[model samples]
Each structure stands twice: as C-alpha cells, then as structure tokens.
Target: MELKGIHHVSALTANAADNYSFYTEVLGMRLVKKTVNQDDTSVYHLFYADEIGNPGTDLTFFEIPRAGTTYPGVSSISATSLRVKDDNALQYWKQRFIEYKVDHDDIITVGGRKIVSFRDPEGQRLKLVSDETNNGVKGGTPWKKGPVPVENAIIGLGPSHLTVNDPDPTIKVLTEVLSFKEIDRYPSLVQGQQDVRVFSTGEGGTGAEVHLETRPDLPRERPGRGSVHHVAFRVDNEEELQYWKERLQSARLPNSGLVERYYFKSLYFREPNGILFELATDGPGFTTDEDPEHLGESLALPPYFEQDRERIEARLKPLDI
Candidate 1:
C-alpha cells in the first residue's frame, strides 16, 4: 500500500498552558482540538494545526507536567521540521522571532535549501525550512486570520528528522516495509561523516520527507519534554490503515494493536531505532467532535471520559490561548 505523507508529529510538553500559548500565540497555529489523552485522562492532549485541522497539519502534544529535558542521542526524533513559502517567509519568521525573543538561529542552508532552527517554549526541537527546494509547494491553505498572516503562516510539516545509531535496519523498514523511496543522500547538516539519508513519498507534501540523522557517537535519548513521542504517517482511510497493520505485523514488527483515537484510527509501533511510529487515517477528523466554525473552544473528552468530566476538568489546567 502506498502512503501519502506524514499525518502528525506528536511530542511531549510539561505544561498545557505554556504549550498552548507557544504553538497558538507564538507559532500562530490554531488550537484545533483541546482534548485529553484517552488512556491517560489526567494529562491534557492538545493539538495544533492549520484551520480545520487538516491531517498533515497536526502537531500534537501530551502535557506531562515537569517531564524534564531530554538528553541527545539515538532512538529520538530530534527535530520536527516545518516548511515556509521561501526565503521571504523565512525572513518573516526571523523578524517575528526577533520581536518575541523566541530561541532560534539565523537562516542556515540545508541540502541546498534555507532553514531556521528554533525551539518551542518547552524545548521541543523544531526548524523552519523554505519550500524553495521541494518538488513543489504544498497546496493546503493556511489560516489567514491567525496571528501570523496567510503570507507568513506555516505551510505544513517538512522533514521530521530522526537520529539513530544505525540507519540500515530503519531504512529497510522504510523502503521495503513502508515503501518509502530513498530519493537522495546528503552530507549531514548537523554532524560530520554521518551523512543524512532522505526518504520521500511517491506523493510529496506535508508529511512527504524524512531525514535520517545517523549519529553513532551520541547515546540513546531519554523520553521527556521537548522530545517527539511519535511520528505518524498518513493513511487515506480505514482500508489503508488495515493494510499497513497487516504489513507491519507480517514483517514481525510488534504493534500497539488497533487504537480508537476518537478523531482517527491509529496503529502504533516502534522502528529499529526504538523511535515510535504511527499509522493514522485522515477521516473522522477534528470536526467529528466539534463544529468547524468553533473547534477547540472548550475542553473536549472522549465518550469514556464523559462521565468524569468535572473531575478531569478540575485536574487539568485551563489553556491561556
């Protein structure tokens, strides 16, 4: 089965209120869904994305208070890369970051394209790469009314980089199992000799590309705030989702079983590098729980948690976004 692109990149956060403000207020992404994690209702599961919460636009967070910082190493999604229009768009964000004092670096070229590295308030690694070098700019519309205007708003995800000790096994799973093509290999932008391998989809866009940062010297990373919990690959619908489940299990990869995420159907598993990966469908999306016009207006809970809404609400802190 062919995969479209990335669905969403989920990470951890220590405080929901701060995570909400950083993504919504600083990053200018819309709060598409304000919900709790189904299994762990005590912690908030917040989602940020373009208006209407398109599949590729999702960048979600699980608020685990004081989750601490991560130590750089293997088996970790080191950076979640996002795309902007061009150098002009990169400059737009640079000025915004300058004005707000957001921790970031000046524009740096990567694989012949410009990218500005930045971090969220909770220390989650992120970078903004220009669309100048991709096959074509994504067609998805940005939320024009957001804090950042349509001209400067983030287009969608770019290459969510994964750092690992060995790239062979993970590359095997991606090429043979997931069917992602090894398009090109480039010099490591972040390390010497350890060249980064680029794998892209037959269909390229939001979740189109992934960069394997092969660093054998670095130790394994510990789970904590600022670290990506999982990177989801897009499936057009349930049929695609099921096909992948069988494919992964057939390859002898242990999976999380089928999980009902309310808005989407998901099957999760870890790749060779110990980085968690997910297969997520595009339908029954954010609008399933709330109207398009008023998504993320209030705290939303799954059916199982509906009975204990009051207690859950009281336990979770209100988002200041």
Candidate 2:
C-alpha cells in the first residue's frame, strides 16, 4: 500500500474549444492528447498537462453539450491547483491575471503554501501556489505560450480539492487507503464557510495542498457539466494496483473492476462522502500512439477503438487543433 498521490483530475465541460483555450492559453497547460470521449462519440476528451503528459500532471476535460447546470456544493469544488516557482511567480500570475482580464483574488495559505485563487471560463476554481523546494522535472510538459517562462510554468498539478458533505469517509480513504497524512486544518475565508483539511506526501513541506474542504451546510452535488468527474491517484504498477484493489474491497469500499485504457489501467469508485475517485497506473503512457514529439496532434485511439476510428471521427466535429 503505497498509493502514489493524485494522478490527474478530469472535468466535464460544455465546450471543448473553450476548455482547451482556457487550459492551454489561460492556465498554461500543454494539450497532451486529443481524443473523443469513448462513451460519447461526439464529445472530445482533451488532456492538458506538462510536455509528456505525466500522470498527476494532467487536468483533463470531457466536452458534453447537453449536460445540465450545476452549482458548487459539498461534493464538487473542483479546485485544481498548479505549482509555480516562488512568491515572485505568484505575484507575476496575479499581475498576469489582471492583464489577461481573468478574475483573481488575494492570498490564501494551505499546507503552508501561499495560493492565489482564480477561475476558468466555466467557473472551475483553480489556484497557483509558489514552491521553491523541489526541482524534479522528469518528463515535464509545459504550456508553449504564456507570460510565465517554461521553467517557471506550472510544472504539474498541485492538488485536487474536494468539498465533501461529510468529510469523514473520504478522509478515511485518503489516510487509510491512499497513505495521505493529514497536514493541517483551516477555516476558509471564501464564500462557502468551509473547513479545509490538507493532506500531503513527503514531510508535508513544499508545494503541499492536496486538500479536502467540508461544508456541513451545503447540499451534496451530482455529476453534470462543469463538474469534476473524478480525481485519480497513481500507483507504481500492476502489483501495487492489485494491492490497492484488495485493500478497497477489504475496506468494503465499492470499486470499478480494473479497466484497461491501453495507456494505463484504471479503477474507479466513489468514497462514501460522494466524490468519485480512481486509482490509475503510472507507466506505458501516452507515447503508445504517436511520437512523443507530437502527442496531441490528430486522433489517437486505444487498440479497441482502432477499427471504429472512422465512425468516432465522423461523429466528432473538427476543432482547430
């Protein structure tokens, strides 16, 4: 049971093009892979991350047009954070937000990191925190154009914040199953009047804020457009993955049968608190399709979808890639 921390975060959106621009242009994430959602032939499953599309680096999206309106509540505060170089970069992003006309707010501390909160066009909450401690950039994928330089660009996803109706169950999963140690607790000054508990790996220093915030007064959320569909945690390989699967079953937590995505194998389930979670493998990743040099250009499909590629391609409307 060493469940590597969060793998990637996936969000549902009404428009792929807008979501793509917001992630790559506004938030400065590289679009690593572009493919249609397997279940929904017409919608795109866009993966944005550092250069090589590392797990934990990605913030993916599924474009669903007819998906309904949703509100931020206990189960759905999809605050995906990015780690920048230092306080200087934090200040730079604050100014950059003003220059780009993106709304932003002042400092908030989580797990000792100073974070500035902002929103995408779809109102998904995102933050940028300054971390000067670690410089490990193995396979780092950065946004091509932004005010922040590639070195200072968001190295990867910092955390995926889940606001739960009842934090106990989810908290148990993080601490017991996922090996995330609770680092701190704080009162949120934001609109939700929430209580935030942060969990992290390492000694809990540096850019650590894989947080869980709770709002006892808020209603629970359901899946739809502009919602975080799930948050994934990484495992080293199939051995660690099966260990987690058995642990989840022994704990009586419901889990998806291991599903192969070709690039990696994934298992999905919901914590008792209602937020969806997935355990994803870390190797044999995105380079399976095109060259590592050109990952997101053109359509890339799993072996299962190769023959049906034409039908899937036909259903999806072209976006300027």
Candidate 3:
C-alpha cells in the first residue's frame, strides 16, 4: 500500500508557554491539542495545525523544561517547512515577520518554489514554502480566527529536510524500503557539496517530499531544544499501519510495531543514518476526544491516562494559549 504525505513532525521545546505563544500568536496556527507526552507524563506535548488538526498539518512539540541547545550537524531533521497559499503569501509573511520582529531570511527560490527560512525563539529551523504550483496532496484550511490574515496564513506542513553523513543507506531506506521515488535534485546551499536530492511518495508535491542533504563532513547531531525528534508519514488507517509494520519486519528493519498513539496508530523506526521515522495512521484524529470548536482549550488525556489526570496536571506548568 502507498503512504500518504507527511503526518506530522514532532520537535523539542524547553518552554511550552513560549512555544505556545510563538506557534499560535505569531504563526497563527490553531493549537488543536494541548496534552502530555504519553511516554513522559511530566512534560507538555503541544500540537499546532490548521483550523482542525488534520493528519498532515500537525506540527507538534514535546516540552523539556531543562533541554539544552541543539548542536546542528548530520543525521538530523534539519528543517521543517510550513506551506503558504502562494508566492504573494510569502511576501505578506516577510512583512509580517518584520512587523513581529521574527528572525527570517529574504525569500528565495529552491526546487522550483519560493520559500522564506526562519527560526522560532528557541532557534527551530523552519521555512515557509509557497504552494501556488502544488497539485498533489492538498493543504489544509487556515484558522479563520487566527491573528494572521486568512489569505496568507500557514496552511500545512511541506517537505522535511534530512541531513545525513552517508546518503546511500538513507536513500536505500527511503527508496527500497519506504517506496519513495527520487524526483529531483538541486545544488546544496553548502558550497562544494553534492546536490541535495528530493524524494516523494504518494501524490507527490510539496507536502510529500523529503529533501536529503548529504553532510559527510559533519558530526552526528546532539538533539535538544529546537531539534526535530522525528518525522512521521501518513498511512491510510490502522490496517495500513499493520501492513507497514509487517513490511518493516520483512525488510529486517527494527521498529516499534503498531503503537497506539490514541489519536493515531504508529510504527517508529530509524533509517540507517539514525534519523527517526514514523508511519502513522490518518484517522481517529484529534477530534476523538476534544470537541472540534473547543480543541486545545483544556488539558486532554487519553483514556488510559484519564485516571492520572490530577497528578499529570499538577506536574505541568500552566500554559496560556
């Protein structure tokens, strides 16, 4: 079975409150889920997306109050992209970033599309890509009531950038194992390096691409605040997730088989370069527990964690969104 585009990219953040402010207030994405990390109940796990949290639109963060700075290097998810409606929307965002004092670079074209790179307060490497020419997997609707104008608001996630020491092994996993097709390549921003490769899966476009940057000279990344923890690709449903688990096993790729994430089922594994990858189902989404209109308004816990809600709430610092 073919995989859909990206499901979500989860990153690290030391301060949930500030992370909440930047993503919601500045980026104008909706905070679709306010919850705790299932693996670590002591910290906050926040999700930001378009109006309602659609599978491919979510950008999540796991709060680690004492997390240190990320040492950028190879074997990392170097950059995460958010899609805007068009090139004109990129212009609007450039001026908005200026007005809000958000750190950003001038708009530039890459891989035949315009993009503007930027960083959050915690130095999360991010970019806004124009979807004017996109015709594959569709983007989501922007939040109508968010701070940014609806026309120029961030819609959904685009391609994720992966930096690796040896591209061959990662490329093998992406192509032979996961069935991503190499579609294009562009000169690396770093001088004298090989051109960055672009790979895409089902319904290829901005949303379905993985840009591979080979950095043989760099060391392995030391992940902390602002570092992407993992990038997940979307599967159609639980049955498809099971098929993927079997496929990973058949390929002798070690994985976390069929994890019940509550909102979605998942299977986690690392490509040969040690970059974490997850295959996640698209259904039983964020609306499973929270009402659509009032999502992210209160602390939400899965059924299993409901019993410990009081203890979990006691440990988390109040986040004002």
Candidate lDDT values, in order: 0.84, 0.75, 0.94
- What TM-score would you give candidate 3 relative to the actual structure? 0.99
lDDT digits (tens) for residues 1-321 of candidate 3: 678999999999999999999999899999999999999999999999999998889999999999999999999999999999999999999998999999999999999999999999999999999999999899998999999999999999999999999999999999988999999999998899999999999998989999999988999999999999999999998888888888899999999888888999889999899999999999899999989999999998999999999999999999875
Candidate 3 achieves a global lDDT of 0.94
Ranking by TM-score: 3, 1, 2
lDDT for model 1 comes to 0.84
Tens digit of lDDT per residue, candidate 2, span 1-321?
A: 555566788888988888877777766777788987766656799998887887778878988888786677777646777777677778778877888888788876655568898977767778887776543322245655544577668877776788876788888888887678886777776675766887875334433336887778877775677678887877788777888888889988888878787778888888887778888898788887878778787888887888888888888878776
How do all models score by TM-score? Answer: 0.96, 0.91, 0.99
Clash count list over all predictions: 1, 4, 0
Better of 1 and 2 by lDDT: 1
Model 3 spans > 4 angstroms off: none
Worst 10 residues of 1 by lDDT: 132-141
Q: CA shift at 252, candidate 3, in angstroms?
A: 0.8
Provide the lowest-lDDT 10-residue window in model 2: 201-210
